[model samples]
Target chain A: MLKNRTKIKVKGLNQERAINNLSKTIRIYNFSRKEHNISEFEVDYNNSKHIKKMLEGQGLEVVSLKSRGPAFFIRDFFKRGGLIAGVIFVLIFYILQYSFILKIEVWGGEASQCNLVKNFIEDNLDSKLKHNISTEELEILVRNNFDFVSSVSVAFVGQSIVVNLNPSLLPDEMGTGFSPLVSEYDGMITEINLIQGTLNCSVGDIVQKGDVLVYPYVTDSSGKVYEVEPKADITAQVWLSGQEIHYDYRILTYRTGKSKVQSQVLLGGLVIYSKTPDILFEDYECEVYTKQLTKNLLLPFKLKKTIYYEIETEEIIEPFEEVKEEIISKARQKALIFSDKNDIIIDEKYTLSEGGGCHIVDYVVTVSKNIGG
Target chain B: MFNFFNEIKNKASGIDYNLLNEYNIINLSGKLLYVEGHQGVTIINSDMVAFKIKKGRVVVEGKELVLSELTSNTLLLQGVIIKVEIF
Candidate 1:
């Protein structure tokens, strides 16, 4: 059976001596590689060690001996099949790891809150797939596990499973009484409109705290208007004057003519390339370059290249009064958005003080409205 | 001399160039010859089997021999190179 076995090259042995030492029926075979010198022979099982010792005595190195398996099988195993097998093994291993939630990415959440919930879920919930646990059971487990969570969905993604928890809903914006747009803080009424209710007070009326500017009940033109299902509760936001201390530190920039160059490298759809190598001069003060590389074969990875011209920034100090007026303008813009009304009337405007290491302008304004005084 | 080398090489089987250059001359006992470049001298004989070069010279180590080509760079010996040595 071993007569036609693949030959192993035995180095450092004389052919005549080796042939004499072996039985007459045994054939000595010679093969050479760039790496090793080999001599192979089909000897009786009893004489295997003897031949090995003989080769060793002659100082010939025996690297490896191949006896079983077809030659083509071993050859193909080394060539293409080796890489394929290794890839398959790695894929299986990753699938197993993902079968257990090795990683979880939470979106639609603030950074701090996301981290808090992540820690909570990781510490409290049992994230394993038990034999008795169904999808419903897992959802119940997660909902019962977390206090802030209202609903949960547990599902298998690829090899691993994921549990997505939706937090509980906030309280209704229209609370107990009639749905009214009340003043968030103490303020005089700004503008008023009896859209769906009666007017509690007219325009230019000076109203105090909790004064209802508009009522919920209304009468129609035909003198046969039905009573509004909502009660006659009144709600209005007073445009109260607020003194806000604001600090503004001004920065002035001076253009510089000098420029620098850098090099960048990109690979595999993502431009991990950040090294910019050369400086380009242009007459414009700012430059924008947009380059897009396809990432993951579908979506685009956008690289916004903004070249900031060399500029020297200088700090410009403004007097207290000038900055104060600018602060009031910004404050009024913010108030308009916050109140959703525009009838702003300045009742009192003044600057408290300034320059104690804190640069701030303080002022107050009062608004008049047609509401219950 | 050219014919001598050509004839001996033709007679020997598996006489590749690697083995031919590795041959060393042990004894130059019989013939006193001049060493010139190729085809300067020639050896003609029939009893010899093979030839081997020893220490940069062709040594006639076989049972009987004849010499023809004698040059400083190349020589021809019509005989078997039984053994070879460097020194």
Candidate 2:
């Protein structure tokens, strides 16, 4: 048996002393939830306020001071009137919310028509939400409202209502019979994947464009031929070729306006006066003019006037292997235009000729692709 | 000293003196100790708690010692109890 007691929790340092003091002051019982610097205990209901004030005087925080008994529960129930009212409101709202159809869904209708029907349902949802309209009544109302719609069914499914409708539609035309699968390009058949069809041709067979590979009819074990829509995947090795002619070397000229001039006088096949090498441009197109200084052919005495124009030259030389690879990649890209997305290249060979001041490259890529209808 | 009073009461009431000689009935199970005969909590701390009995005091030594239940006659001490001493 337990009497109604006031449960108190105090927060401060030296909680041990606080608990000991409360035990001595009042008859404290049911000590629990003890931690470092925090204590919880219960005292007599009449002494709760006095104990709380006594602990406060000692600078300890009275964290919680509450009563634990039937009397306290009754007192709290009347004190928190707004809380009880809000709880009741929520319970009633939950029940009413689930009972009403919040949304209407159309299963067999075009997207725009579904939206139109939904809008129509929403406009009249006030009465439906209030339980004034039933599912059967709503179905008949929808059938009579829309002349194009014939069969209508409105069913309550959980929180929403589903409407099944069939609108009047015109009959469709007859479909054409299935045709035999044919090759789109000329190649040698390498592999054939047949899911459902009659094989008209086998592997290793050479086929041209529009050659039939699978027939539209399949024969049963009893020899009864039935027309079928053939389903198959055919693979054939077709060669795609691309060629490019490139010059063996490329020449580039730089744009430079700087020039330098040099004049020299020579005697007896020996240099008498000349400009130093450092004064001349490293690379230039030089123009030279020579005049006979002495009229002696054996001595060869001459005055030489030279003009050097400064020019900046930048040369980029790619390795032969890299250039060959670049050409092959470009050729492969060009050949890919003639192939389909599902084609897988099995073999690739390129013929390269590097002579006669030009490079001739020819690429042939053999790929397997689906060709049957 | 209280044994003389207990002997007189036992002779007059036909009660066994051995049961009354047991000052504090300590029942220790794992982390919980129930002291049936406790006067009051003398000292309570996270590491230790001391209770005053009839003639002596009982000190509980452990980590995170808590007075889970407390009354004038019974005390429930909860924590990792290492030892208990009656002085």
Candidate 3:
């Protein structure tokens, strides 16, 4: 209701008298605001312009006259036609374009590869709406299609779905076309499931690391070489080794009779208060523990107890024959934890030696793992 | 208690209580003042405002006083209204 009313302000020596005069002329309106000797009021749209001219004729400066209602728009609609048309056109275009992916954009890569990817995506697109398609799935599909594609990312940029590609360096735009599968570890071939490559080794063939298990190009019976990106699954018996040393003698530290326990209240991990008593021991170690003191979730307060234990050190030596089995068992345990969980453990062996107050053990673990990349 | 005494005073003065809603004043928590049956605005300022009522002048004293609404016979006064006196 207030927005539809016309607002007017008049400046004069006596604003109160001016309001009285206006009220006498248009007796049905109400005054809204008055400041700095200027009074403002709302009048009907039909009387606004006439009232402004009437105030001016009375020698009162009409400060502002704003008539806001449906009548003003109807009188001046044709003057703003071009500006309104441009705004409407932009609104319509924005609504139609941003809701769908306009086109695929490749940021970086070989031109041939990018074109090839664009063609593939255009042919396989299920939907063009931004929410209907997943950019991560597109990235994975592009990476899978080309063996030389090092990295790729697909995201919606403005109205277009942009695909940023960083393909690995190849021989040419036509591409070397194929990649050979080589053994990543020295092992004997245990399994070979050739999906799409010529296998050079069979089961039980001993192979070394860097040995090519599949060739890049394949020869047909007509002796014509057709290059293809190689793909296969190979498993091998890989030997992994871990070495660890155990000492027969060690330095032992014990706490003396002197000790001190200091209490502290910690609020949100900050020390709010701590009982005073500086450390008296020259060489001491501190053991800290905390207890929850606040039951309310809003106040996170804990009571921390730091116990200072005065310590003294001494060296203890023992004969190697006394703890022989224990040292070997410890060495084996430490070495086994370093082995891979995915590897199928077949057999293990260890070599033991004695040196300066320590037992040194080297362990070799044999396992079956997928080695060819 | 104030409203009861004012009613008694108005009755003793022989004024009509509900006739045309004339010479009426409503104070809301000393923050807003509404007066009807006003003849004219005699004086207006941040601290004080006076209006011509039927029998005498009604003066409103406060801080940051403002006449929010005005008509031929009614007016709405707003701001921190400290006191309203009849002269």
- Judge candidate 2 at residue A170 and give its lDDT: 28
- Ordering by TM-score: 3, 2, 1
Tens digits of per-residue lDDT for model 1, A41-134? 3433434556666656656666555553355455566788768789889999876665565544443345665576556555644655333336
C-alpha positional error of residue A75 in candidate 1 after TM-score superposition, expressed in Å: 99
Residues A1-373 of candidate 3: C-alpha lDDT, one tens digit per residue = 4335567777776554555455445532445336555766667776675787777766689888777666666556656888779888999988877889777877787788778888888877899877788888998888877766778888888877788888776543224646688988888998988866678899999998889999877667967565666667899888776666666678888999798999999999899999957888888998999999979789889999999989988888876677767766666676567456787989988898877777777777788888866
lDDT of each: 0.47, 0.73, 0.75
Per-residue CA lDDT of candidate 2, range A344-370, in tens? 988988888888667778888889877
TM-score of 2: 0.26
Number of the candidate with higher lDDT, 2 or 3: 3
Which is better, 1 or 2, measured by TM-score? 2
User: What TM-score would candidate 1 get against the native?
Assistant: 0.25
Off by over 4 Å in 1: A1-237, A240-292, A295-306, A317-346, A369-373, B1-87
* Candidate 1 lDDT score at position A206: 54
Better of 1 and 2 by lDDT: 2
